[model samples]
Target: MLGFLTARQAGVDDPLRLRRVESTRRVLSLKLNPDRDVDRIHGNGINTIDIEAVEGRYMLSGGADGVIVIYDLENFGGKQQYTCKAVSTVGSRHVHKFSVETVQWYPYDTGMFISSSFDKTMKVWDTETLKVMKVPDRLLPSALSLPLSFSLFSASCVLTFPCHKVPYGHRAEVLSVRWSPRYEHILASASADSQVKVWDVRRASCSLLTLDQHNGDKSKASSEAVNTAHNGRVNGLCFSGDGLYLLTTGTDDRMRLWNSATGENTLVNYGKVCNESRKRLQFTVSRGCSPEFVFVPCGSSVAVYALHTGQLVTMLRGHYNNVDCCEFHPDYQELYSGGKDCNILAWVPVLRASDVEEESDRCGRTALVNPAFQDAWSSDED
Candidate 1:
């Protein structure tokens, strides 16, 4: 029966069979969004999803309910939908009192992971033990007494390991945090107080540079101490592929690019794009090529833009609800996007020669009477 189907469906043309096989390979080889509707496990929505940098075989997801799950992407059990069995959990009882804001694997290892929470603490957990690996110290400064009135302030150092913990800078809740892809010792963070900070994990002194809204002039250099590129809360930040540039998005309905080394704003404007508002609008940079592109999570669709020019090239539309995050697959020219709709969509470029030929033929001129040909045949004018 199998032999008959192969002969009848594939026919005798070897070339056609080969092309059909290649097309199927490309489609199936693309990654899936992994929208596991396992509400039975975690009652709330997923807040973060991260793919392992080295193997790309496993994925990590953190939910609003403070549940962390590890998913195996490879299908080995011959199942229709790739089953993502939960490897371990922190449990709902001991989970973060607030939402789990971020989840990231150790840059160099697979047995450890880090997660941050609105509870005002970041925890590094041993993936094998499912327990906290390191917990840094905390410090609170004395209340300042002003001439007119007294203002209160407190400081805490969240747990970050493989480095000393003396003074973790943010005085308020940390909104977003990321490790440097190149230098593992360097970490960057954004806060609710409208500040961006760079920290060297080696020392806990003051932040390397405090990005504030007021430097000098609001239009020129921020009049404040830290540079404030966004008029509202700067919720999202990402380093460019080459680590030369940093991209930021805010509630101001705009995206801006900056020189990471000099802390200078590039001022590339993305006009009136609605952000996730409350959640972090994660963005990713495409690797390779002369001109690189940034994939930004804009409302219901993902916007692809040129890095330096800030020109809007194209918009990918498929999500029924607002898109929360997106990442570019470096191995293939494919895109993986996920949203509030609880579904992930994989987009592959359609590049068949026959498809292009059909489009060209449809637009080609069919009229036989050519103006140039008629003009040449006309009798000589007086």
Candidate 2:
């Protein structure tokens, strides 16, 4: 750390390089923080959670009990232990009839947010009033598999409605949708029919590309296996920071990387990711890291994997039940995860030994650290 600082001070190293290295180290050292906690508000499992990108000081969460909560993540008070308070909530009366599938704050500000639910309704809400600002046409539940809906905030007709009946789109329910960070018009959708398609919103006549797991290798694919992203349902889809590469997870217990522009499967085998969710799975990729990391919910734990190499970095085992969603706060290099256990766990970067005082203070801090953060690997094999 001192060497990098000295090199940076001497103008011998790039400033961004030092930041990326430190960010990567922090991500690797992420552990369940005993001090930072999110106040429990949901009676049922948390389905989705998102931190606003503008300030990164507020978080939005939706739960299976049809509740939506907005948390103030900024810790203004000087304190070691802090619980993120729910500043606003939408509960009971006007709440969705079923599980709230997703909640997201408006891209530019915190004054507006949007939420969608299994009740076949999507609503736009005013942050201050906590009341519906706009309620679009309620969707008719599709007979195919799940009654999936995408919360697309836009002016286009296709964006307003779930485009299932399109001549060149997924025949089954579209389980997941994500817009590319690099391209405003580029979109990716995963469906129950075991296909992943990339679309250009302006040209809705057909998808720009349909990802193939086989990568156009006909001899290696069976008839049914040809041009499919996964053998089972593809529930998760995430793009790399640059939007040059894409990562996908499916019920087939596998995760694959793909070249976004060419639709070529990079085939970096992230072996047996253990995804059993019948709905959309929310996973995230790390930002400001040299070789990025992927944080995904695998059963009760959040699995960390190397983005390019497909190497398992660590397993964050803090949740008691199946973890449904996780959101990364890039500004602080912290992670927030929610699960069926009705808990939201904050995984924070551990303070380096040098950051502490001499011997006594280090010993005291070590003793107070949560056992859940300790590595349980056995040395017996060695």
Candidate 3:
């Protein structure tokens, strides 16, 4: 980090390069922070959490208890020991009849947000009033609304296409859905049927691409495995920051990377991700890092993996039970994970004093090297 700063000061490197380098270092050094806590309001397991993108100062969490809570993440008191306080909650009245599967803040505005649940219903909320603004159409009778199922959100109406009615809809339940970060109309959906499909919302008659794990290699595919993205249920789906690559995890205990544009499997082997979740798994990717990282919920730990190479970076091991969701705060380079332990743990970047000390020690050692043993060619020539 010092070297990067020196280069930036000398105008020898781009300012953006220094930022990326520091961000990557911070992400790599993430550890469970003792000073930070999120108020535990959920009586049951947390299934989903989303940090608002507008200000990155507020967070939303939905739990299996059919409750939704909004937390103020900004530390206004200027203290290291800080707890994110629950500013508002939708607790008793008008709560979902079953587990709340997903909650997301409105991208352009913090005044509203949306949530869906297993109760076959979706609700849009007015953040200030903490009241249900509208209950959108009930989910399809056969469709249990899992996390990441909703397609679109607007200020007035929450729209979800009955993709089940499409020409090539999944026969089984859809487990996850993600919109491309690069393209507004392009969407991806994964299903319990082991298939991943990309759709253009404008042309909803049929999917645009059906990802094949085999990448059309006839010799590697059997009749049943021809077009499937995984051998078992594909429950997790996350797109890289640039939306060029897609990462998926399945009940088969494996994660695979895919080329989003062509629907071809990149075949970077991320070994045994150990995903057994029957519901949608929420994972996230780092935004400003060069070789970006993916934070995934693996049983009781959140597994960090390199985005392109699929190498397991590290495992965050604080949750006592199975972790259901993990979210990354890009601005702060911090991570928040929720689990069946009924706790929300914060992973923060450790201090850099040790790095400075190491650098100084190396310099001191070089200076103390024996003068007689040192090469004197340069001194002699001078």
Q: What is the C-alpha lDDT profile of model 1 across 1-382, one tens digit per residue? A: 2333355466743444333333322322233334332223455655566666667666676667777777665557776445456566676456577767577776457787777666656667788888887543431111111001100111224422233655445545455666555555655666555667776656636667665433345576644544555677667878886677777778878777767776667766667767755656667777652245678888788887657767664677877878777766555545666566755466654535564344223222211232221211222221
After superposition, candidate 2 runs with Cα above 4 Å error: 135-166, 354-382
- Show pairs that collide, candidate 2: none
The global C-alpha lDDT for each of the candidates, from Candidate 1 onward, is: 0.58, 0.79, 0.79
Q: Where does candidate 3 stray beyond 4 Å?
A: 135-166, 355-382
lDDT of 1 at 30: 33
Those runs of model 1 whose alpha carbons end farther than 4 Å from true positions after fitting are 1-42, 75-91, 129-172, 201-205, 211-226, 348-382
Give residue 92's lDDT in candidate 2 (0 to 100): 49
* lDDT of prediction 2: 0.79
Cand. 3 TM to true fold: 0.85
> Judged by lDDT relative to the true structure, which candidate is superior, 1 or 2?
2
Residues 209-288, model 2: lDDT tens digits: 88999888888776773379998988898899899998999999999999999999998978889999988888989899
**Least lDDT summed over 10 consecutive residues: which range in candidate 1?**
143-152
Considering TM-score, which of the candidate structures 1 and 2 is the better prediction for this target? 2
Q: After TM-score superposition, what is the CA distance of residue 57 in candidate 2 from its true location, in Å?
A: 0.5
